[model samples]
Target: MGIIRTTVFTGLLTTSTAAAYLAARNPVISPLAATDPIWTSSVFKRHNPSRNPATQDVCIRRIPLDKIRPELLQREGDLALEFCRGVWSGWGFAVQRKYLDLKYRGPETAKQLWTNEELAQSTYDRGTCIADHFEVVEKTPTAITVRCGDSPRKQDPRPSDGLFVISATVDKQREEVELRLKTCLFSSEGTIQGIKGPMPAWMEEMHQWYARIWSETGSWRLLK
Candidate 1:
């Protein structure tokens, strides 16, 4: 059988790209800062050797972090905040907190061990919790690291290392942010052979563009 023709959908995910400064941080004050044009414009294909019909399909969405509603941001931060708040509450301290810190001793996933239902609910209710600036920069995605701003120096227990770093700017606070975004749609599932491969012309053109862009746009940032 030829590569199964999967019904895929693509759309604009979120905000656009832009630069801004902290409105509150005046001239005399120091300013803290940080911060895809794909699909529809381009086509990506799976390159595998299996000839069987593919099993799974994927949808690609570019979630512009900048445009996400404040309510949405708050909701996303809930679980993270609760994890941190829980740590403080257990010690009988109930002051306002802005960040969450989590760790696991043995070999296990960080999210699985850190998550708790009550903590999640508490974090959402507070809505006051916001991740620090440093958090965003460290979390942005990179092709090399997958997770943006992730320092290669640190080690992770997650066996498969395939996460994308997504970051966005919000408000005038110059709060840099990073998120490891994932979707079931990005994966190439089912019969490997049935998966269509990149067109020869597109592959050749992409390599040429990559080289040109890297040379012109990525002087200090070497892309491989």
Candidate 2:
């Protein structure tokens, strides 16, 4: 009787442990996920003189994990990294060869990780716009944030002190994800000193176009 009871107890313990492991590995879906892609933008705001004018654009899309290719899902970071790569390539930005390779600083299975300690830079629009470096500032199983520093347009009279931040989040339960891009234009001097003239209409239009492209097709292109 003692031997039978011990075996039964061991079996129950093993089953319970397996159930807990599975639950921990697979997170539940988030409530914020939507049925369709949603895009939104905010007017530029300056919180400080040293900081640049901040503008935010967000795109949220529903992507069922079961629908995605199994191979791509296994990669984990591929979706977010691919989206970043696509955006730069689509915008005509070329990352310098020296910064092309990224070395992540954290464990492979870490929910949050950082990359590009060497500071990768990219140039766009015939060297008119230069981004100093790319850094993975935040990461998690469901979210990631990429930041671009020392970005500025050649046309701007002030020095290049602006930056851009791009973030992506996944909601498994809702079967959706969200991508947000925020651009900040800063000046060495105070915000008052930074202003030379009104922003050109063409520049504003170009930014709007880029936002639209990322929201509509660029974010999901890799999955296809």
Candidate 3:
């Protein structure tokens, strides 16, 4: 009887430990902030007055700061910038090398940004291909916003002449910090209407996949 009781107790302890470990690995996410202005104001509205914009929100992860030193927040900010810039490449997406120059992070001067040029090669995905221009319309220590639109050089407007905005923000509250990514899609192009149902679904899938990739590999790169 003693031997059997000891074996049962050991198995129970092992199961409890495994459950606790799983809970720690997946943290809960809390609300961080309202919709940003770039999404609300800048996207496709400039080109098509009647355009209705759609937003997709992805709560990447909530990081616990209790064990980490306070001074590391600056490092976190830099990591956030790197994550934003490298996300597309890190995900192994098909991207044209020429347009990669538009992924700048810091403050931008008039000439240094892609305010009036096409974003990247036409070989990019359909939604991305419509992004003719990109500019760093907003930048701060904790947040960065990139605006995308149609080429200013074009005389006639194409239905694809819409706007897409990507914003990354770091919000710290008490013992935890939240990193969130928000994207807005505004398109006037007639072709987009046909793919509207699948566009958002695809974007959400890509966003979640990138988040997992960042959590597994990119976050560790920051620590190194």
Candidate 4:
């Protein structure tokens, strides 16, 4: 009943706009019960660096599952991990993990939030606040993917590490609930570069406008 904590995870890269409206009026976004990803040995290996591909920066969102929010469906009963833990407790994702604990995608991933050690990467575990230098790889109950720990900081055209993908599925003939936001880039001579961050095109259009409002209002605002 108190598993899901708050703070941004996907399609997020900062903590500015007033900490995303105070993480959108904080209710801890209920709807827990969709948690997994505390493995190690670093996995998810897929690189294709010919130039630009990872869907050329992407974002998609949908939510309907009876318009959500009955104390976020009470708890873990897996509705695609309760819509991916209600889009990792939606709304501006704790100013996008406080903008990666102020790393801002630089100092080889600055503060390393939740640096694991069996969930010392806390936000009370499970629910997730992202950023232990991005590593999840892939989780189930719908989908989750996180990657990055490869670069030593090459600097070739800018970008270094890659992949920040999220997925949650449950269409059930359109009852609704589908979320995907991908920002794949890797070109410190590594490869697989999407949206090749040569840096400064308004910071790649403000990180594709914060990954399209962190995927259209952070997982469709869990029943707005």
Evaluated with TM-score, which candidate comes out highest?
3
Q: Best-fitting candidate, measured by lDDT?
A: 4
List runs of model 3 lying over 4 Å from the truth.
1-39, 42-49, 66-82, 85-135, 148-174, 188-221
Per-candidate Cα lDDT values, in order, are 0.23, 0.39, 0.39, 0.46
Q: What is the per-residue lDDT of model 1 for residues 66-96, given as tens digits with 9 covering 90 to 100?
A: 5333454454443223223332232211122
Expressed as tens digits, the lDDT of each residue in 1-224 for candidate 2 is 32453355346436756334323322222221333121121211221234333333333444566644456456666566555554554322322322432333223313221222211222111122223344343344433344343322122324434334444556677775555554444343345443332235476445544444444333444454
Q: List the residue pairs that clash in candidate 3.
A: 159-189
Candidate 4 structure quality by residue, lDDT tens digits, 117-161 = 322212222323245445555565555656553432322233455
lDDT of 1: 0.23
- Per-residue lDDT, model 2, residue 185, is 40
Q: Each candidate's TM vs. the true structure?
A: 0.19, 0.43, 0.45, 0.29
Better of 1 and 4 by lDDT: 4
Off by over 4 Å in 2: 1-49, 91-160, 193-202, 215-217
Please list the residue runs of candidate 4 whose C-alpha ends up more than 4 Å from where it truly belongs after superposition.
1-41, 44-68, 71-137, 141-143, 146-161, 167-184, 188-203, 208-212
lDDT value, residue 120 of candidate 2: 24
Native-referenced Cα lDDT, model 3: 0.39
